[model samples]
Target: MVIILESLLGSMFEALLDYSEGFILRQEVGGVG
Candidate 1:
């Protein structure tokens, strides 16, 4: 149970981090486009 929660939280945090990074990448790509 504890492990499951920890993994879930980790994935959620990773997704948020990826989202922010992707948003920045989109902006950079937009400028290049």
Candidate 2:
């Protein structure tokens, strides 16, 4: 049970990181264009 929760939290954190990075990249591209 604990292990499952840990894995779930890890994935969520990773997804959040990916989303923020993508958002920042989009902003940079928009600025350049």
Candidate 3:
């Protein structure tokens, strides 16, 4: 149970990072174009 919760949290953190990176990239591209 603890291991499953840890994995879930890890995946959520990774997803948040991915979303932030993508958002930043989009903003940069929008600024350029």
- Superior candidate under lDDT, 1 versus 3: 3
The TM-score-based order of candidates, best leading, equals 3, 2, 1
- Candidate 1 vs. truth: CA RMSD? 2.3
TM-score of each: 0.65, 0.80, 0.80
TM-score, predicted candidate 1 vs. hidden true structure: 0.65
Give the worst 10-residue stretch by lDDT in candidate 3: 24-33
The candidate 1 region of ten consecutive residues with least summed lDDT is: 24-33
Candidate 2 global lDDT: 0.93
TM-score-wise, the better of 2 and 3 is 3
Clashing pairs in 1: none
- Alpha-carbon shift of residue 29 in model 2 (angstroms): 1.3
- Kindly list the per-residue Cα lDDT of model 3 for residues 1-33, writing each as its tens digit: 999999999999999999999889989899563
* Candidate 2 structure quality by residue, lDDT tens digits, 1-33: 999999999999999999999889989899563
Q: Residue 5 deviation, candidate 3, in Å?
A: 0.4
Of the candidates numbered 1 and 2, which has the greater TM-score value? 2
